[model samples]
Target chain A: MWDYTDKVKELFLHPKNAGDLENPDAVGEVGSIVCGDALKLSLQVDKESGKITDARFKTFGCASAIASSTALTELIKGKTLDEALKVTNNEIAEYLGGLPREKMHCSVMGQEALEAAVAHYRGEKPPEVEEGTIVCQCYGITDTKLKRVIKENDLHTVDDVTNFTKAGGGCGSCIPDIEKILKDLWDGKVAAESAKPGRKLTNIQKIAMIQEVIETEVRPLLEKDGGDVELVDVDRSKVIVSLRGSCTGCLMADVTLKNIEKKLKEHVSEDIIVEIE
Target chain B: MKIVYLDNNATTRVADEVREAMLPFFSDLYGNPSSMHTFGGQVHRKIEVARAQVAALINADPEEIIFTSCGTESDNSAIMGCLNSMPEKRHVITTRVEHPAVLNFCKTIGKRGYRVTLLPVDKLGRLDLDELDKAVTDDTAVVSIMYANNESGVIFPMGDIVNIVKSRGVLLHTDAVQVAGKIPVDVKKQPVDLVSLSGHKMHAAKGVGALYIKRGTRFSPYIIGGHQESGRRGGTENVASIIGFGKSAELAGNHLSAGNSKLIELRDKLEFGLSETCPEARTNGDTENRLPNTLNISFEYVEGEAILLRLNEFNICASSGSACTSGSLEPSHVLRAMGVPYTAIHGSIRFSLSRYTTDDDINKVLDVMPGIIKELRELSPFVK
Candidate 1:
């Protein structure tokens, strides 16, 4: 069992504001059954006094989440609109004593529902997203902005992009696009850096240099053993090279490629993608 | 906040008097009972006294008791020893809901080319005695059934089982680990050949238990070494724990009537409060035939782990479905044998009372439980 605080227990056992409000001015729903928790909150707004006359909630979650909703409802009821707006998720957690760290998201959900209800009362729209062409379709990331953000954040991998912008964190169908975007940003940075007087070849220029080196130096050595080398493609700094002829079905093909990929990556960038097929 | 421990069937806190009895053996009286000296002789005498005390609790001969490590070891020894005594007789009979100690051992022995018959239980956790009678054959070597289920606390009809086995000239072994100290047991009156008891199930310390082997019954030693437990089980004696077990047994015998009534009352109160407060919650097993201190309830829609975690917030300790609580993926074999629905299986909680449980403790649980269950149910995915 998770170590629960005394306050969390207090609120869970004796929840302050549970159930539903009759004929509420605004209703806010957050989460869903699939997410494992949901909350339906209602508020009675006192328009003349610009205050919340009553607040109630029906929450579906573990003890902490339900307690958070209950405490959030209790904290906002009978308070003015401005006072209710100050009720944060942290404040809800504190009111319920304290919540588990993983369950902090539940408290956030409660706060979101409260804010949504208050926004509904004021006839306000949800915060808008500026129009941009979609890039990472998994999380609906926009290409025009996410590319800039990727560059600004110096993202390098699919995971880094996801963490920074929630791009590949969803279905992961757009992971290849996220990877391509990260590669483009990295290549652009390298190109800009190497264009200076003292700097050298960019990643693309470096891959071309290695391909030339493989054709002249590495391929002839492998051809002597009845084998040949072929360059596939380079994404970012990773060079994809293939082994042909006898090397294709040889037992030592792995050993030959290991030797070649190692030498090429050592002389060039370390992020080379060397595969047999 | 004060902690409320309601998971007594898992294990009980050692009683003060039992602890006191064990204290001396840990220091001044520390001697090998098998050693030949006044120091050892005193320890040997205490061992005898403990033997008699344990025997008296079960109404068996002091000579019949052979101390072993724990209930599991006792069970393994009984089942294996019986099989060894009659190597040609391969058939073994047991109930579906027997503790893993017996069930697993029987399974292992079954793999070794023995024919084993598992008797099924009804919804209330009671075995069909008629079925048991038919399952036993002339070649049956042993009939091993548990006195009470560890999870459901449903007491088995040992008297009927014993009579059936005795008429067929088959040996009977009862894993009385759950029932030994919680209720009265008399091996002589029950006409069982073997019975297993664990000290920790009572208020004694862990690592010490005993198996009762009826006099004139054929048996063999599972553990072999230099003479200890009359060469039945071979190991250096666990003196302090043995003394504690004896003391616990004595106390259990004396307080059986009052302790049972007190525990039952508290259990009923908690069960009543839970059923009244939480809709669609019902007790598992037969209410009247269950162990006095145990109440297993299945709360609809909510999972047992979620409920236990919530109850932990209040410093209230309880047990859940045997599978979830024990880190097994499968639900309890006992509950499954009873044909309990899967919808209710995941939410089952076992609240076991002890002699230490008080009315105030029950009230505190009752007061806090409703809100917890209601809140959890609201969040439950299956709640409609």
Candidate 2:
């Protein structure tokens, strides 16, 4: 009951080119039994044209892993080595319509195997293989690869990184390390946000902006309606204010309240909510 | 496609007799058992009959049977109730391969500052009783073990476990969810303090179960709500499910006394056929000491979920202990605790039979299973 797409089920139940190639141009493998998913991918590259003539794969994994591997093998065949290398894990997952979020690492596994196989075909070192700092011991994911997955997938949380790179998915001992890394990454973003204009503002900047909007846009408009407001406090997204003068117990106080809320949202932040104290 | 179900350990079909017994309670005899009027008095009498019926299956007195919602509730009530009754005892002992109902609860208790000792099992899923003897200390409140494993269907030596735990003056509880109807589970023979059994594991409905609390055992109610179940359990009785459970117990008692020869014969034929055709396939548990109606096998180099999907194509229902099938990154804890090789662990399949299993069901599995293995093995990288 993993909610696998029809395409994923079809590929899993009947995988195309599911076998091991002997005496092939090159071969690659990623994952292991301990990681709960492993794949052995082989390529039959046309040496003269530098094109992949055929591809075969054997995977030991769940439904989505097998389906993703099968789809990757099918997607890369009859294409040039460069074109095949350009196939992303997201593209492979998309080829199968979709996969469950937690099973997205199976698609990442397909990407790793493809990179390793293409590197083997070219007689170069397999790029980004886990010789770097190990971050996730359970899945053998490294810091360098994990960072790239996070950046490319726009992952902001530990759970997001687990889905994209399989880091912290097993034993969960590395979850603190993953959280530290995410905190570091977001810390850098917070600093960059201070410099970037018209981007998401810092917390202090948001507070200042809220106060300025209330002083310039809200107070003048309320004073014109024979009602005045005073800013009381700003609690995260909430802007607390006190009704003074004619605004106190006024019949149209609700209308003024609605006007203040709408103006704050437009000028300062869309999530701002105004409340009369 | 006609289905051949071999996953009776997971859940059984509601028997016709059980269903028949349950129907009147859902409509005409719908009075609450706690009421005082004649309409309700008749329903209360039926509940008393049910208590006797459930107790008769295990040779316990009617007062010893405390009806609960499910196996998990019965287990929780047994372990947590024991801990509550003896708040001074700071230790608990259990085997490494108990169902999550007990295993996870023990883990939570460990987090709550209680010491827990998990005894290991051998490669054939047999316990070393000496380890159990040594692990028990004066602080131990209860040693909860299972009479039979659900994943591998390996039967544990209850007599030895009981003697060892009871000798130390520690309470002995057995999660007999898998062994109750499949084999003889009479409380009259074993002097264990508590035993938990599920109605669904037998042929009754899913919502009802019973716990056997020895007459002199110290206890506390898990749900401390009402004065129902003789102050042992709370809430209104699940009238229809309780009735179905009673009828299923009577039928299960009949099956046990008459001997489940048909079940054993079909199971043996299926096991022999699979073992003869495929040399790589090996059974996981002790062949002689395991349940007569269960067979767990692992075909090396072929993964379990793929094999299950293929078997499902043939309208055959079974279960696997493989990591992929369970959505966990690791395979079954029972298989892992027994030190089963990782190569075969990913491919393990469990086929559990029942009295309803027929020779034709055995024939379909034997005919189609070998080809599925061959097809998957052909695609496997390790097979070559």
Q: What's the TM-score of each model vs. the native?
A: 0.62, 0.86
lDDT string, candidate 2, A175-275, tens digits: 88998888687767764644324678787887787777778667876665446788888888888889986577554678778888897777777788889
The candidate 1 chain A region of ten consecutive residues with least summed lDDT is A191-200
- Candidate 1: residue A3 lDDT (0-100): 55
lDDT of 2 by residue, B181-286 (tens): 8889877788888999899999999999899999999999987788999999999999999989999999999999999788888888898899998769999988
Model 1 residue B160 CA deviation (Å) reads 0.7
TM-score of chain A of 2: 0.69
lDDT of each: 0.78, 0.86
Candidate 1 segments exceeding 4 Å error: A1-277, B257-259
Task: Give lDDT: candidate 1, residue A48.
Answer: 92
Question: How well does candidate 2 reproduce the true complex, by DockQ?
Answer: 0.20
Model 1 clash pairs?
A: A60-B379, A61-B379
> What C-alpha lDDT, on a 0 to 100 scale, does residue B49 get in candidate 2?
92
